[model samples]
Target: MDEISLLEQGVSFVLHIDQHLFALVAEYGAWLYAFLFLIVFCETGLVVTPFLPGDSLLFAAGTVAGAGHLSYPLCMAVLLGAAVLGDAVNYEIGRHVGPSIFSRETRFLNKQHLLKAHAFYERHGGKAIILARFIPIVRTFAPFVAGIALMSPVKFLSFNITGAILWVAGLVSAGYFLGNIPVVKNNFSVVIYGIIIVSVLPVVIEFIRANLKK
Candidate 1:
């Protein structure tokens, strides 16, 4: 799918996750926490899947945490572990299976595109694992690209951990802080959009910068 279509899917998935959070909290609260953690992992780890919610889910989970319906520390731990491990797993996959994946006749993915991702990841391998924390599509695909390029595990780990901690901390804190206000508490959907824009801001800035330089 196109970038716009993928973004729409991301928003839809996040909204669905949010709408179901109350029921999820009621029926199987702890499991829902794990479920959300897994969703974040898959969205960031798997190159073929960007449909899962990332920013919005984290923020919503944080809001729930502040309400004391969920334990904030526990949620933070689960999500942090998931995000870090997910990228590590994807890095391994790209290292070993990337070529085979590129050889396949997939409509949405191409070997040339994979090479481009690889080169970009190579030139900015450290940032691939770090800055990706802020970008939507880049965050989802960056690890996969790193794998394709066989980035050093030690280097990847260093940057991956840093990014995971900062990304989770920032989003969760935003939820914890802003979620308490009367306006924010009532208009949660606006917060979701704000998270998306924040997530995309880096990409938008880079795009503008490249244009200005040209």
Candidate 2:
């Protein structure tokens, strides 16, 4: 598919994850768990796939689970594992490529994003690993930048695991509890957009702050 079509499909999925995800779970049955795992993995693990649904998907999954369509424990476990493993793989890839990779530009990779993530890492140090988990594009690039900076594997793993757990659990649990409310369930699109806005707020604030400093 072309870029515009791909973008549109992704947006649609995120906005209507409730309906699309329910149909997926219903049709795929047990395999839906694996599918979700792959989606989460790609979104966090691959820089080029940052546009893939992340926060919204998890929320929708939790909503479905709350409705008794899927097992919450199993859903949580699968996604959490995918997220941790994805970051580990991304970090390893960056470590192998080193900092030089960031100097080169490609259609799939954005240099500005790498620079922003690198700066975020430098300013926040180790905490950037956890903080980036809440930001969309940065979340994908943070581990790679950490690896380029040659962060210790043990140190990276500690924060990576912690962030993954907190991110997945917090969003999913919120959907489970809040999504079940009559108002929320009836107007889930609004809640999903709210989640998206809140998720990206940090990046927006940082962008503004950087410009102000300039």
Candidate 3:
């Protein structure tokens, strides 16, 4: 598909994730797992794809699994790995790009700034990485920034694995256990919009607070 077509489809998927997921389950059947895996991976991995569905997708997948169309345990495993590996890859990319930007001063960028960022990330990377996993868009950029700041791989991995487990298991299990409720099932799109808002609420609050401080 062309870029515009892809963008339109992506937007449609995000807005109607539950309906699209149901259609996917109907059409792709077993192959839906791979699609889910890719969505989770890209949403978590690529900075450009922060717009892709994460929380809602997981919940919808869990709902499908709960309905017996998919396997819950397997889905959890697949997504957990995708989440972790995606962050890892993003970190590596940032790590590689960071040095070049820092090796020399630009008209606008300075080595001292990068040094301060590195120091800040070193001190707070662990908690930030774990917490960021729950917040949309922030989760996508947190690890990349950590890498740009050169957070320790060992420390990053520990928190990355822990956060991925909690994020995938917690949301998916919520859907598995609760998604079938008549009210949630009937209002799945509303629930999805609510999830997206809640996921980004922290970022929104922080932005508002920063603006007020200024």
Candidate 4:
């Protein structure tokens, strides 16, 4: 497929991840674990790929595990590792070159998103590392911003590990426990949409609050 076609397919897959994940698990079996790891890693690790699925992906993985197609402990471990490692890489990149790239919005980098993440980090301090895990774009940039601000490695790692554990375990557990229910199963797409909305709701509120002050 061409780039545009591939991009379209990717967008569709993310939007309907609950369905696509099932197909992935069925076709790839054990390899699905690696796929999940990559998706989680890139989504958290790369600044430009924030649009990738995170919250819904975990939840869908949990649901798959709940169906006995995958192992819960293994899923949690792989995803948690991916999340932490991704942030660590992103932090390092930021520490090394944040100033140069952040000077202007490049074709790939969105300066506004970085600024928003920086503002969040400023307001919440180290806690933003934990809180940003639940927010979409902010989570992708929070660690990078932290690195730019010269946050200590020990402190960033502590918060990064804690946030990854909570983010993976909480959402995955929710899906494991609830995703197979008749209501959720029949309306899986709706549930994914709900998860995305809930994940970004804080950002929406923050934006509104910021505008009100302006």
| Two-way lDDT contest, 1 vs 2, winner | 2
Instruction: Please write out the lDDT profile of model 2 over residues 1-214, one tens digit for every residue.
Output: 8999988887877888888888988898888899899999998888778878789989988998898888999999999999999999989988988476766768878888888889999999999999999999899999999998899999999999999999999988987877778999899889999999999999999889989999
Cα miss at 39, model 2 (Å)? 0.6
lDDT of 3 by residue, 2-96 (tens): 99999988767776776777788899898998998898898778766776788988898888888888899998988898999999997887788
**Could you give the candidate ranking by TM-score, starting with the highest?**
2, 4, 1, 3
**TM-score on alpha carbons, each prediction:** 0.84, 0.96, 0.84, 0.94
Give lDDT tens digits, candidate 4, residues 50-117.
Answer: 98889989999999888888899998899999999999999998899897877766999889999999
Model 4 bad stretches (over 4 Å) = 1-11
Q: Is candidate 2 or 3 superior in TM-score?
A: 2
What shift in Å separates residue 168 of candidate 3 from its native position after superposition? 0.7
lDDT of 3 at 80: 92
| Model 3 residue-pair collision total | 0
lDDT by residue for model 1 (96-187), tens? 87768766777765455455456557767578778887777677778888777777889889989999999999888787777767898777
Off by over 4 Å in 3: 1-11, 99-124
Q: Cα miss at 10, model 3 (Å)?
A: 4.1
lDDT of 1 at 186: 75
- Count clashes in each candidate, considering only residues at least 3 apart in sequence or on different chains: 1, 0, 0, 0
TM-score for model 4? 0.94
RMSD of each: 3.5, 1.3, 4.6, 1.8
Model 1: which residue pairs collide?
Answer: 94-147
